[model samples]
Target: MSRRQRAASLAQGLLVGMTLGYTAYRAVTLAVNARRFPRLDRPHAPLRQRPRVSLLTPARDEAHNVPKLLQGLLSQGADEVILLDDNSSDGTGDLARDLCRGVPGARVISGAPLPDGWSGKNWACQQLSQAASGEVLIFVDADVEWHAGALDAVLAELERSGADLLSCWPRQDVGSAGERLITPYIDLYLLTLLPYPAMRLPLVATATAVGQVMVFRRSSYDAVGGHQLVQGDVLEDVLFAKRLKARGYRVLGALGGERIGVRMYQDYASSVNGYAKSWLPVHGNSRLLLSVALAGQFCVYTLPWMLDFPGARLLRVTGLLERSAVAWTAGRRRPADLAEGLLGPIGPLLQLPVYHKAIRRKVKWKGRVYEQ
Candidate 1:
């Protein structure tokens, strides 16, 4: 073979070998942390007594979600179920009120106008907190549905963990082909890299939180200023956890398991917009830094299948198992999730367009445009 051709083959060989090594390390760590990820389904001692729990929901144009969400919240036996109608054009308020009407301790509150500096949901959440009378507060998104015994399970965990904030990453549900393609990425993305144990430490960098369901002690919420502290942050849940850590408070994370589920996006189109709003900011919006991170992901995940070599094939098989294992912990076991594991390369490729829009800071949600 010519010298140039030999050099090219060597470079490709090195890249494949490196990818295999990284994937191998990831596989081992995933196995080690598999059962370690907290599950809420197990039995536990309930909270000492009724703590006057409040379920606060912030919604805008979520007519489709109100029925399921409110139904679950009402049945959960919260002290109060308060939903803030954040200037929705849809008749979400009417639906919520009708569902909550005659149900003591459950009511819909009309949200005030959006303030200049605050984001819509944050403003709505701040108002919800101000209106709440519970000693424990849970900020739930309109998209999440709580399963039976969910509130009891949550309260048990809160008391057991002794954490001021317990962030529950719900079971991500995928139905459509587009949903299948992208929804599982979140669970896979976080579990593989984030140090699950370090999260227990009061360290800001290792802090993370899933926004869909966050349980907070009212005392701790007021101590740190609550959503008002992170009104402008696009990644509000994660930032709020970091704020708690910086203040020397404990923050715990757990898997929702069978307790709760959320379908954050209905299809591929919505998924792109949903992810684009926060990913670039997660990388601090530096193109160079984001590019490096994406490149590393591509090399580790997407490039293996494009090559013809023994190491490449081995990496692909092991990577599939790894992805599937993480997906199982997420309560994701479907034809779609199986495809997600086998087609691991598609995850990073799908992220490209979303990252592009994220860097430009152009996003629209619920008929509102945000250039921030």
Candidate 2:
């Protein structure tokens, strides 16, 4: 072969080797994490002494979603349930009040006007923190759904581990085609890459948290200054977790394990827009870094299918194995595991629009705009 052709062959071979090595490493990590990651699925026996628990929900224009959450919270037996209505254009406050009428320890609070340098959720959570009077504070998003004994599982895990913060990663229930196309990547990104077991150590750099469901000892919340420290931060959950670890506190990540789930958005527009709001900020707001990462995602998940040369099929097969490992670790059913993993190539391509929207450094969410 000519020198140019020989050089091209060598380059392709090198790329294949790197892809294979990385894919193998990802598979092993996924398996290890699947076993090591703490989970909130076990059924808990009645505790000898239950702590005073305050359940907090922050709602803005979520009248359609809050009813189910509030109803679930009533059965969970928290000492207090506080839902903050953050200036909703919809009748969220009224609806919440109507639902909680005559219920003991359940009430709705109207959020004060949004002030400068405070993001909407952070301000709302700060207000909730001030109103709570429990030994433990549990934050639940308005749209989250939990199974029977979900709260029991959370409290049990926190007590057993003796951790200050227990951040439960909700299992996503995707009903739309767009959701199926995008949601698995989020799962794969966390379950496959991060060493969640190391969270026991004070590694602020590895700190990650899901705000959908978080349980914090009231003392730790006060110590970390609550949401006040991460005011105006779009990615408040992660930032809060980092601060907790930096201050000699403990943060543990646990899977929902069928006990908790959330359907973040309903359709394509909502899905894309929802994710765009924090994608750039999550990557440190560096377009160059994010752009390179997106390109790398393309190469890892999509290129093997695009390439028609020999041995590309093997790459595709191994990619499926890696993706399946992630889906399994995320607790997907067998059929879902096969289907989502097979559709892996489409996810990376579909994420481009989210990345593009985020790179602009401006994103709108719940009728408010924020700079990344």
TM-score of each: 0.93, 0.93
The digit string of per-residue lDDT tens for model 1 on 94-178 reads 9999999999899999999888878788889999999999999999999999989899999988888888999988888776888
C-alpha positional error of residue 188 in candidate 2 after TM-score superposition, expressed in Å: 1.3
Clashes in each model (backbone N, CA, C under 3 Å)?
A: 0, 0
Candidates in order have lDDT scores of: 0.83, 0.84
TM for candidate 1 is: 0.93
Query: Which residue segments of model 1 deviate by more than 4 Å?
Result: 1-18
Q: What alpha-carbon RMSD in Å does predicted model 1 have with respect to the real structure?
A: 2.3
lDDT of 2 at 324: 70
Q: In candidate 2, what are the lDDT values of residues 210-290, reduced to their tens digit? A: 889889999989987899989989999888888888988888888887888787888777888888888887888789988
The per-residue C-alpha lDDT of model 2 at residue 42 equals 59
